[model samples]
Target chain A: MNRCAVIGIGQTRHAAKRDDVSLAGLVREAALRALADAGLGFSDIDAVVIGKAPDTFEGVMMPELYLADALGAVGKPMMRVHTAGSVGGSTAIVAAHLVQAGVHKRVLTVAFEKQSESEAMWALSPKFPFQPPLLAGAGGYFAPLVRSYIRRSGAPPEVGIKVSVKDRKNALKNPYAHLLLPDISDEVVEKSPMLWDPIRYLETCPSSDGAAAMVLAAEDSLGGVTNPAWVLASEVRSEPTMFAGRDQVNPRAGRDCAKALYAGAGITEPRRQIDVAEVYVPFSWFEPMWMENLGFAPENEGWRLTLDGATSMTGDLPINPSGGVLSTNPIGASGMIRFAEAAMQVRGTAGAHQVDGAKIAMGHAYGGASQFFAMWLVGRDKP
Target chain B: MGEREIAIVSFAEVIVERSDRDDCELLLPVLKRALGDVGLTQQDIGFTVSGSSDFLGGRPFAFVMATDVLGAWPPIRESHVEMDGAFALYEAWVRLQHGDLDTALVFAFGRPSQGPLHDVMSLQLDPYYMAPLRPDALSLGALAARAALDAGLTSEDELARIAGERRGVPTSTSEPYLREPLRAHATPTLRDGAAAIVLAAGDGARALSKRPAWIRGLDHRIEPHSLGARSLTRSVSTEQAARGAGALGFGADVAELHARFAHEEPLLSRALELPASTRVNPSGGALAQDPVMVTGLCRLGHAARAVHEGAARAIAHATSGPCLQQNLVCTLEAR
Candidate 1:
């Protein structure tokens, strides 16, 4: 297979509502930025791959069809990927495969969500026959999982609070982050109302409108590009939503996905080799929960890594230096944002959040009640 | 990278005017038949992918629930596309090109019976410009049909004959128009359906079928969303995709065109440059039963079936968006 590399990355300034631009405008902004970053234009793209959570999120079914002209995909191969929350990452992986498979020399991949267009809660909680309503929204669905984690781990209550404080503070350094809370602190987090049991409002991600795009090229096509982030490996794994003995907290799909990813990249020790990480932490507790699931930390001990400041910007491995999904929760774009930020770190263009001398990084995303996983590893050097 | 040979080994679909069965229920039997056709079980598949729209189900993450049909117990390397099943098959074909994977299971399901399909499909238009105008899908088809009629590319009589022949019914030119130029016969028969196609690479493909429908070329393209911005009479995207997929030079023995509207058959036949001798829509095509998301994939399956069933070569065409704004073309040949 031909090697693939991330030649450019672009993202919108996440916000509660980007009323200034329509859905097409929002995506075009990111696509234009990505094309410019690659020192290319729309005409340079061989194909386009787009992903978003649900069409209901923006009241548009098959948005990519309408978005064809805006993305400059007219008369070119274009595809739409939808794997729920993991869609962004999955979209990127599919784009990379197109390059790796040598089908396309350059590919543009995009993911976005215009949450302001409709109530995602209403869309997600639609009542179906013989199926009970999910009135609690995403938080309600995950709070029980958090409670189970806490009960099993015996971790202190402050772990989630610490993660919330750290990530929001990190958001201050990211100009495009939606929530740059300068006043975020332990006191403020504690005062925040609890939306779900043991899950404070401050610990959850806010609904935001944004889009992220990446320009990926085959190794041979990276002639004019400098400092491209080589994609070492990409993997996606899925499991049935409900089955016997399925572990939601540390899902087998996640563990198997990580194992497959590392094995593909020939990385025996992820914690030591991976210089930085960008993981989907929609909820604060998901940081530690995903850490264990991704094999970054042992089961029940993931919180200790957070408490020890090991995941901080100045610590051993900075997680979500761009503040992650918690700070900018455009459901569809969240996963691609993680993947793009990881690439930026390796490209040494992450600006204030850049991990110093970072050569290798990991990006992870999960969706569908933690039953789906998409992960990729990028390095400064070609694999 | 070296190009790898991939072929469609098996195909199955369930089409109905309206399905009382749920998405999973509709998909289970199709999946079983698709797997059984290749003499392989779900466990034997290397990857699983699906294409569908959550909007059709009036819920979010609808495809996740549909995974129940795959019996995804041990977890699988899978992905999904919020598109026609042909796109999912494209993704699977791309995955198999990586050399590590062999067989892939692809399926698409939709039940348009839950809501007004015209209004539902209108949601696929541009929200800022087109959707607010609420131009229903049939109206768009009418507009295209009118454009083609005015351009002298086709006529009302030709459309009537195409519809009648495909539907195996008598066409009435005197019937009242459903949407100006488009009569009821010209519009698609919105239905509920599910389709599954199993793909295998190289040795696996040859092992699965006595005459595998080897995918010689597969490509898809999209056009501008605005109907006024481009010529509605011709499908530029389909022609481009046909050229890219190498379906232009070869003459197909049979063609399964996803002509959701009667007027689309002539547009696609022209775009694909199909031979006059080609037999189009032998299985009646989309006019017989248009199952939204599954209709496009069913075109591919039907075309593959021809090659698998001893035809020398065939062309499968799938379309998306309003007025044929997007198109996918695949060239299949027996090997």
Candidate 2:
């Protein structure tokens, strides 16, 4: 297989409403920026791969057809991936595979969610025939999982608040981040209204309109890029949404995916070998939950890493230095942002949020009741 | 492009006018049959990918529930596409090229009967310009048929004959038109259906079937979305994909095309440039049983089946979008 590298990355400035641009304009902004970053044009791309959470979110079925012209995909192979919230990460992996499989030299992958176009909460909580109504939305569905994690790990209520504040503070450094909470503090998060039991309003991700894009190319296709983030390993694993012995708090798919990724990348200890990580933490508590799931910490002790400040920007292994989903969540693009931010970190182009001397990084995303998981390891050196 | 030699080992499908079963229920039997045909189980498969759309059921994340059919206890390497199953097969083929995996499972399901499929398909158009007009799929097809007639690419009588031949009915052009140039017989018979295919690579493919449909070349391409921007009388994407898939002069014994509208048959045939000896749609084609998402996959399955059954070579075509805006062409040979 040919080695694939991230040559360029771009993202939109996330906001509650980007009504100034149409859907085509929203995606073109990121695609153009990514092309500019690569110092190439639409004619250079061999294919286009796009992903989104669901068509219901945008009320457009298979929007890639309409978006072909906007993305300069005319006369090129264009694919649409939908794996729920992890779609963005999966989409990138698909694009990388195109290059790795030697089918295409350079592939453009984009993921976006114009949540301002429609109510995602309503789209997510649909009541099918003979099924009970889902009246509580995503936060409500996940609040119980957070409650279960707290019970199983014995984590204090303050851990979630700390993570919320930490990520928001990191967001202040990211110009494209949606929520720039300059005065984010534990007291403020604690005083916020409780949307769900054991889940505060400040602990959840906000609905933002944004798009993320990346240009992945084979080793030979890196024209003028000097700091391309070489893709070390990429993996996606999924399990049944519900089963008799499923572990919702720590899904087996996530564990298996991480195991495969580390093995492929030849990493024995993720916490030590990996310099930084950008994980999908839509809720603040997910940081700790996923840390354990990803084997960064021992079972039932992930919260200790949070309290010890090991995951902060200046800590030993900074997580989500680009603020993460908690600070800017465009459901479809959140995962790609995580992947793109990790690439930025390894390329040393993260500007203020750059982790010093970062050589290797990991990007993680999960969706569909945590049943689906996509992860990849990238490094400054070629694998 | 000598990547990896992949072939279709087995295929299974179910078609119904309207099924009360949910997506999982509709796919469980087909998945089981596809696995059983190759003497393998879900665990033995290296990767799994599916293509489906959420708009069909008016629900979000509808494909997640379909995973139950696999009994994925240890979890599996899986992915999905909001497209026809033929594209999902394309993804699986790419995954197998990594050399770590030997086999992959691809499937697709759709229940267009639950709602108005034509109206639902209109939403796939440009949201700002086309969707507001609510031009149903049939009307768009009519526009293409009119363009084809005006360009002298095909005649209304020829479309009627093609529709009659595909539907196994007698040709009668005197019938009243459904949309001027297009008659009721010129359209596909919509249905709810599901399809699954098992693919194996190299020696693995040889061990599974007596004769594997080795995929020599596979390619898909897209064209502009605006109807006015493209030549409706011809499918430029189809012609490009055919060239990329190396099917231009590679004469095949059979060709299976996912031509939902009867008028698309000649258009695709012209794009593919098939020899007069090549038999097209021996399995009745989409005009017989058109299952929104599964139709394209079924064409591939039928083409592969011809190779498995003794044909020397075959080519399969799958199309998407209005006026065949996107097309996938796969050339399979029995070697």
Candidate 3:
């Protein structure tokens, strides 16, 4: 298979409402930036792959069809991917596959969600026929999983609070982060309103409108760029939403996907080998939950890493230096942002949040009751 | 087109005017039958992907519930697309080209019968300019038909004949126009359905089926979104995709096109430059049963089946967006 690299990356300033631009303009903002970053134009792209959480999020069915002209996809191959929250990461992987499969030299992938267009809670909690109402929204569904993780891991309540504070503090350094809480502290997070049991309002990700994009090209297509983030490995795994003997907190799909990714990247020790990671931690507790799932820490021991400041910027394995989903979530774009931020770290372009001398990084995302997972490893050197 | 060779080893589908079964219920049997045809189970598949729209059922993440049908106990490498199943197949084909995976499962399901499909399809238009106007799918199709008629590319009588041929009925131009230039018969009969296909590469394909429909070339292209920006009388995207897929000169014994409207058939035929000898829509095409997301994939299935049933070569076409703004062309062969 041909090798692929992330030659360009761009994202819009995430906000609660980006009323300044239409959906077309919103995506173009990032796509144009990515094109500029790559020192190319729309004409340079061989294909376009877009992903969003759901059509209902914007009440626009298959928005990619209409955004084709806006993204300069006319007379070009354009695909739309939707695997729930992991869609953005999967979209990037799919674009990379186009290069890896020798189908295209350069591909533009974009993921976005205009949450201001509709209330995500109502959209996600729709009443289905012959089924119990899911009125609790995403937070309520995940709160129990957080509780289970806390109960099983015996992690202190302060661990979740630390993650929220650390990530929010990191958001201050990110210019495009939606929530830049410069004064974020453990006391503030602990005193916040508790929306769901064992989950405070500050611990959950905010609904923001944003878009993320990346230009993936075959290794040979890198024009003059000398420091492109080489895609080392990418994998996606899925399991049934609910079944007997299923573990929701530490999903098997996430573990299986991470195993394949690490195996492909030849990383037997993720914690020591990888310089940084941008994992999907919408809920602050998911940090430890996913840490264990990703093998960054042993079972029931992930909380120790977080409490010991192992996930902070100055730590050995810095996670989500771009503030992560909790600090700047646009739902669909959140995953791609993680992937893009990881690429930025290895490329040495992550401005204030840059992990110094970072050579290898990992990006991860999971969705749909944690049954779907997507992960990729990127490094400074070509694999 | 990559280093790895891929072919459709098995295909299965179920179409109905309307069904009480949910998405999972509609897809489980089809998935089982598709895997059974190749003497393989879910565990044997290396990769899995599906395509469906959340707007079809007005439920977010509707495709998630369908995973229960796969019984993915050990967790499988999987992905999904919001486009038609044909695109999902394209993704699967790309995955197989990675040279690690040997087989993949692709499926798609839709229930346009659950809502007013015409109006729901309008939401696919530009939100700022087109969707607010709420132009139904049939009306958009009629506008294209009108453009074709005005351009002298086709006539009302010819459209009636095309529709008649697909529906297996006699043509009569005296019918009332459903949307001026389009009669009721010229429109497709929407249905609810699901489809599944198993693809294997190289030795795996040879081991699975007696005669696999080798995919010689596959490509998809899209045109401008706005109808005013495009020449509605012709499908530029289809022509481009056909050329990219090497279907321009490839001789095919049979061709299956996802032409929901009668006028689209001739327009696509001309775009692909199919000779008169190429039998079009031998399985009656979408006019017989247009199942939104599954129609395009069913075209692929029927085309592949023709090759499996002794056809020397076949070309399958799948389309998306209004007025054929996007198109995928795949050329399959028995060799």
Candidate 4:
């Protein structure tokens, strides 16, 4: 693969509702910021790739086509990617390839979701003759998984609340993160309205109207960048939605993506080498669940890390320093936010939320009954 | 950087014909054959990627059921693109180039029958501008054809000849005009089909087949979605795709095109720089078959099969999106 690096990253100020702008306008804000961050204009991009969940969520079909002009995709190679919840991560992977394949340099990738514009729950309505309606948002789907993780791993309940408080508090440092709760407390998290039994309201991610963008380039395109996160490695994996005795709580696909990513980045000890990480944890408990899945901590002891404050921004290794999807989730863009946040950490451009002395970071995302996974490791040093 | 060879170790595709299979059933078997032909199972694949569109199927996440039949046990690495499978294949190819995985399975499905496809597809245009006008896909193609006609790029008679001889249906007034400038014969028939191809790297390539259709170059580009912004008579994107695919400076043995319209054949051919002697659409091309999203990939596969079977040496060309709004070109050779 051709050498590639993340020279610029931008994200919209996530909110419950952004009625001031249309969906296209919401995305262009982020794209323009990213291009500005790279000291380039939209015309500098050679291609554009969009990532979003099902078209039903937004009532738009293949929006990259309709959005061509706003993203400066005129006469360019434009594509749209969808993979249930993991679309944002996968969308970035596709854009990275444009540069990696030597087909285009300085490719722009963006992912967005405007859930406030429509009722996503009804949009996620059960398809005829498949799974019956669980009437569960992502939190409902993962609460059982979180319960299973708690039971299988024997993690205490407080671990989840702690993460919830931690992320909301971290959101204060992020101007673009939705649900800014600077004074977030465990009591506030525990007392919030509970949508699902095990998953408290604060523990669950918000349905945000937001977008994220990144400018990926070949190594040569990085001349003026103050700091850039080189693509140490990227990997994506998937497994059957339901087979005999599938592991939905801590899926093997997530594990495989982690192992492959770590291997490619040449990091044998993830916990020791990775200084920061931004993981897709739609539910707070997923921080521990994915920590185990991503090999950042031992399977059963991942909760202890959170309990010990080992996963906090001030911890030895901070995770989700940008408040995480649990704080701001636009579904499609949530995964890319993780990827971009990780890139930001390594690039030393994380602003107020920067992980001090961070040289290596990892981004992880999963979707679809825990069947799809996309992960990447970025480093300050070029690999 | 170093050369990392990739191969189409296994391949599968349903014929570009009207199918009675349900959306899931119609798509599942094509993927099953692709994995089976390579003597591999879903578990053998490290990554999975798919291509498809919801508009074509009248339901969103239309490609989701593919995971059920693909045996996504224990969860697998997966992604999907809302485009043709050819681009999905390109994404898989890039994954392999990064040396993270050696083998991958790429698949795509579309059933044009599931909805009022042309009317639904018009939604892909700018909603505020084009959708307000209700510019159906037929009218768009007709608009492009009219531009060609006005430019003397082709004639209605020539278009009919290409449609009749190659497409098996020539333009006729009897069929009634769906759009004013487009004749019934020149427009491609609405179709339903699925396709899949297996990609492998290096030794995995050699192990898959005696004659692997090694992809020398592959790429795709898109013109703007607006009709007013582009010169519909010629495809600058197709030419760029061909140039990036490294297929033509001079010539090739064959050019299997995916043009759905009669005039589009000449339009795309001139863009790709196909020699006059080069055999074009020997297998009757998209004129004989087109399964919407699957047609572009089927064309590439047709040319690849031709090369694999010793029917051609080097093959090039592809068509996708509205009025060839997007184009892909790949050179394949027996190795």
Candidate 5:
């Protein structure tokens, strides 16, 4: 692949209702910021690739066409990618491919969701298929998995509350975070209503309306930026939702994606080597579950670290220092937010929320019964 | 030709007519054929990508069911786009440039019989502007056709001729006048289809096929959706894209175009401006099988096939979106 570097990253202020701007306006907010960061204009972008969770989530079918002008993709190649929750990461991977493939010098990638305009529950309502309809709402789907993790790993239920409290507290530093609960505590999370067994309202990600944008440029396009997050490695994986003997818990797809990401980036010990991680844990328990899946910790022992405070914001390895999905969950953009946040940490551009001395960062996201997985490892140095 | 060569090592298709089974049922066959054509299984294809839309199926994550047929049991590198199979193929091509994956599988499927085609397409128009009028694809083409007529780019006779030549079969025949200005024969037939293209790198191409359609140059461009701003008669986007791809030459052979309407044939012909004698749409093109999202990929596959099959020296052009709003020109030649 050609040398590709992320010169600019931008995001809209995450919120519950952004009625002030239309969907196009929501995306432009982030795109313009990213362009300015790259020290370039829209004219410098050779192509655009967009990603979002579902069309029903925004009530726009193939929204990229409507978004072409706002993104300055007019008279340029534009492609739309959809991979459930992992779509944001997948969208950036496609943009990176433009530079990596030696096709375009620079590509603009954006992912967003105006959840205020549509109901995620209604959009996820499964019909016309033989399988059982999604009933857990957003949290319900992951609750059983969380329960399985607890039962199989012998993890105490309090571990989830710890994650929720830690992420919400971290949100205080991120002004763009939608749910900045500086006052949130473990007791507050535990006191919240349990929407799903083993999962409380506070332990789950919020449905936010926001957008994230990143400008991926061929190495030659980089100019004024002193620190650039050269993309080290990227990978995406998928598996059948249901098969004869598929393991939804500890998904093979997530494991494969992480394995590829680490191997590509030449990371031998993710736990010791990875400085900061921004994993997509829409539900709190997933912080440990994905830690195990990504090989950051053993399968059954990941929760032990969470309980031991080894995975805290100031612990051995910081996780989701930007409040993660637990802070601002824009469903579609949530995945890319994780990816861009990783880039920001490496570029030393993550405002007050920056993880101090962070060098190697890994970003992760999963969608659709945890079957879709996209991840990338970014470092301070070009690999 | 570029430094790294891209090739269509294998292609598979499933014509999803009013069949007894569902769209998913149709996918297994096409996918198997595409993979088997290169003597490879799902595992042999290093990366997987797909394209589809939820509006057509009236359900979110419609493409999720496809993984069942793909047998992603061990999990595989995969992604999806909501555009067309052609764009997905482009994504695969880009991924292959990393020298990570030698072969990639690309596919797209939709059931036109399942949804109201015009209304679903209306969902693609400018929401604040044209969509309110419920401007279906035919009307959009009508506007473009009227513009072309006013511009004297081509005559109605040229469109009628294109309609007659694009459809050679009987059951799927085209008549004059579906939406005044766009004869029924002139409009590309609305059909349901599933298309898959297996792309390979230079070394992979050498290993897969004796003759591979070396993808010399592939480029795609989109014009703004605003009807008032864009020139409907000519695809300036297409011209710009062909120029960017450096695919402008008097192609001595042919150009397999994705012109959905009869009027579009002339407009795209003017935009890409293929040689006057170039054989266009010999496979009846989209005029007989206008499978929206997959049609553009089909045009690309057909052009590549023309080269690998030793039928044409070079082929250029593919037109997409409503009223030729977006276009792609991929110059192909056999190495």
Candidate 6:
């Protein structure tokens, strides 16, 4: 297999509504940035791989077909990936695999969600036959999982509050973050209205319109990129949505995905060996939940790490230095955003949110009742 | 660069006008047959991927429920594409090149009979431009047919003959026009179906099938989304993809094409530059039963089976989007 590296990264300035640009325009904004970052043009790309949460989110089925021209995919192989929320990460992995497989030299992968185009609340919870109406939206569905994690972990109620505050503070440093909470604090998060039991509105992610893109190249095709983030490993795993004894909070798929990723990257100790991470934490409590699932901490012990500031920028294994999904959740793009930020950290271009001297980082994304998971490990040095 | 050899060891599909069975039910038997044909089970597959669209099911994460067919209890390294099954096979092909996994199972399902397929398909058009117009599939197909006719590429009688040949009928059988130039017979029947294909690489493929369909070249290309921006008389994407897949090098004995509309047959034939002796739509093609997502891969399956059945070389084409906006060509041979 050929070595692959991330030579370019781009993201839109996430907002509640990007009315100025159409869906195609929204994607082009990120794709153009990525091409510019790589110092290449539309003609340089060999293929295009795109992903999004659902066609319902934009009321357009297989939007990539329509976006062929906008993304300069004419006369080029273009693929559309959809594995629920992990689609962004899954899409990136597909692009990298093309390069790794030596099928293409330079592949452009893009993921986006124009949530403003439709009501995701309705789209996500549409009534189906023989299925009970569990129309609580994303927050309601995850709130109980958060409640279960809290009860099982026995972490103080303040843990979720601290995560909300810290990520929001980190968002202030990210110019492209959707929710720039300059005045964010734990007290403010605690005082916020409880949307779900023990899950405050502030603890949940906001619906935003944005896109994320990256240019993945075979090792030899790094035209002018001096510090490419080498793709050390990537993995995707999935299980049925419901089965006997299935743990939703800490899914087996998530664990297996992380295990494969770590093993592939030759890192047995993720907490000590990894320098930074950008994990999909749509809900603030997912920080600890996923930390445990990813083996960054032991079961029920993940909260302790968060409580001890072990996931903070100045602490060990800083997580979500780009403020994560909670700060800018563009559903489809959320996963790719995590992957891109991880690549940025290793490239030493994360700006204010950069983890100083970060050499190795991990990006993760999960979707659909947490049954699907995708993760990748990137390092500054060749793996 | 020469790619690692991959072959289709087994293929199975079921096409019906409409089925009481759900997507999972439609897929289970097909998958079982495909796996059994190769003397393997779900566990034997190293990677799994599927292609499907949720909009057809009128719900999100519809493909999630289809996983029940895979018996994903212990979990599996799987992924999905919101496309036709042929594209999923393309992904599996790419995955096999990693050299870690030797076998992969690919499947796709769609039920066009359950929804307003024409309107639903319009949703695939440019949301800001074409979708707002709500142009139905037949009218769009008619527009392309008219373009070809006006460009002197084909005649009305040729389309009728193409449609007749696919239906095993004669053009003398008069059919009413659904759209100005497009007769009812020219349009494909809406079908509900699923298809499964097992792909194995190198020695594993040889071990699986005595007559494996060796994929020599596989490539897909897309065109601009706007119908007005393109010349409907020609399939540039098909030409590009056929060239990429090396289909233009000479000709194959048969070419199973995913031409949902009659006019597309000639367009693709010209694009791929198939010889006159090349048999087109031997299994009646998509016109016999166009099950949306499944039809494309079914074309591929049929073409692979032709090679497995003694044909020296064959070509399979799968198309997505309106007016052949995107096309994938795969050339297979028995060696």
Per-residue lDDT over B170-286 for candidate 6, one digit per residue giving the tens place of the 0 to 100 score: 764366788978888888888999999999999999999999999999999999889888878889989988888889965799999999888889999999999998999899997
What TM-score would candidate 1 get against the native? 0.99
Give the Cα error of residue B287 in candidate 5, in Å.
Answer: 1.3
lDDT of 1 by residue, B59-133 (tens): 788898876679886889999999899989999999999999999999999999989988888888888888899
Model 6, span A14-126: residue lDDT tens: 99999999998999999999999999999999999999998889889899999999999998999999999999999999999999999999999999999998888777876
What is candidate 1's lDDT per residue for A15-38, written digit by digit as tens?
999999988899999999998899
RMSD of each: 1.2, 1.0, 1.0, 2.6, 2.0, 1.2
Give the interface RMSD of each candidate: 1.5, 0.8, 0.8, 2.6, 1.5, 1.2
Candidate 2: segments with Cα more than 4 A from true spot: A129-134
Models sorted by DockQ, best on top: 3, 2, 6, 1, 5, 4
lDDT of 5 by residue, B63-127 (tens): 88888879987899999888778778877877777776789899988777777887778878766
Model 4 chain A worst lDDT run, 10 consecutive residues = A125-134
C-alpha displacement of B144 in model 2, angstroms? 0.2
lDDT of each: 0.91, 0.92, 0.92, 0.81, 0.83, 0.91
Positional deviation of residue B149's Cα in model 1 after best superposition, in angstroms: 1.2
Candidate 4's docking class is medium
In the range A137-254, model 2's lDDT, one tens digit per residue, is: 7886788889999999999989999999999999999999999888888999999998887879999999999999999999999999999999999999999877667898999999
Please write out the lDDT profile of model 3 over residues A171-207, one tens digit for every residue. Answer: 9999999998877888999999998878899998999
Assign candidate 2 its CAPRI class.
high
* Fnat across every predicted model, in order: 0.89, 0.89, 0.92, 0.64, 0.78, 0.81
What shift in Å separates residue A41 of candidate 4 from its native position after superposition? Answer: 2.7
Lowest lDDT sum, 10 consecutive residues, model 5 chain B, at B168-177
Question: What RMSD does model 5 have?
Answer: 2.0
User: Clashing pairs in model 3?
Assistant: none
